[model samples]
Target: DVKVTQSSRYLVKRTGEKVFLECVQDMDHENMFWYRQDPGLGLRLIYFSYDVKMKEKGDIPEGYSVSREKKERFSLILESASTNQTSMYLCASSLYGFNQPQHFGDGTRLSIL
Candidate 1:
């Protein structure tokens, strides 16, 4: 079975602080994604990587960046955290193919004060 693991299920940080979120997949998938979920706004893609050492910016990438130095691990970096960035961050991994289903992590609920 495929599994996606997040480093933390809850996180708290202050404004202007740097934050790092980590995710790992066990299925050796070729695609990984980071998304932020908010009520009403739904899930907004933050970034995605098709292969190791490659990344693409998603819908909301203004204050965020990603690193995929290893195929099993993906990291999300918040350059400068702010109150507006507080939300549920989710990580997903999928096989490289058309219409492939993504396996998601439990998510990290981030709070910025």
Candidate 2:
């Protein structure tokens, strides 16, 4: 089984503060994704990378950035966190191909005050 580990389970920060959440995958997956899940909005992809040093912005990338210096690690950064940005962030990994299921981490619940 593939194991995806998140650096933090929960985070609390004030508005305008810079924040970062990290995720690491045990298996060598070529595709990694960062998504933010909201109550009614559903899961929205924030960023993704298919290889090291390569990244692509997902649906909602404003005020957020990602880095994939290594294949196993992906970091999500909030340039200046806002109360509206507070949400459950999820990380997933999978092989770059069809019919592959992405293994997901527990998720990080962030709160901006």
Candidate 3:
């Protein structure tokens, strides 16, 4: 089975601090995504990489960036953590395309103080 692993299950950060969340997939999938899940907003994409060294901004990319230097790993960087950015961050992977169901890691719940 395909598997995605997130670096953290929970995180605590102070406002204005930089935060890094890592994700790794073992399936050699061509697509990886970072999304923040909130109470009523559901899952909002933050960034996605289709291939090594390639990335695309998703619905909510402000204050966030991503790195995809390797095929199996993707990293999400929060330039400055904020209270509003405190949410459950999820990492997902797929073979490619909307037709494929994305397999998600458990998730990282981040709290900003």
Residue 102, candidate 3: Cα error in Å is: 0.7
How far residue 5's Cα lies from its native spot in candidate 3, in Å, is 0.4
Query: Which candidate ranks first by TM-score, i.e. highest?
Result: 1
For residues 10-82, could you state the per-residue lDDT of candidate 3 as single tens digits? 9999999999999999999999999999998899999999999999999999999999999999999999998
Span of ten consecutive residues with least summed lDDT in model 1: 94-103
TM-score of 2: 0.97
CA lDDT of each prediction against the hidden true structure: 0.98, 0.96, 0.96
Tens-digit lDDT track of model 1 for 1-113: 99999999999999999999999999999999999999999999999999999999999999999999999999999999999999999999999986999999999999999
TM-score of each: 0.98, 0.97, 0.97
Candidate 3 residues lying further than 4 Å off, grouped into runs, are none
The local distance difference test score of model 3 is 0.96
Lowest summed-lDDT stretch of 10 residues in model 3? 94-103
Stretches off by above 4 angstroms in model 1 are none
lDDT of 2 at 63: 96
Q: What's model 1's overall lDDT?
A: 0.98
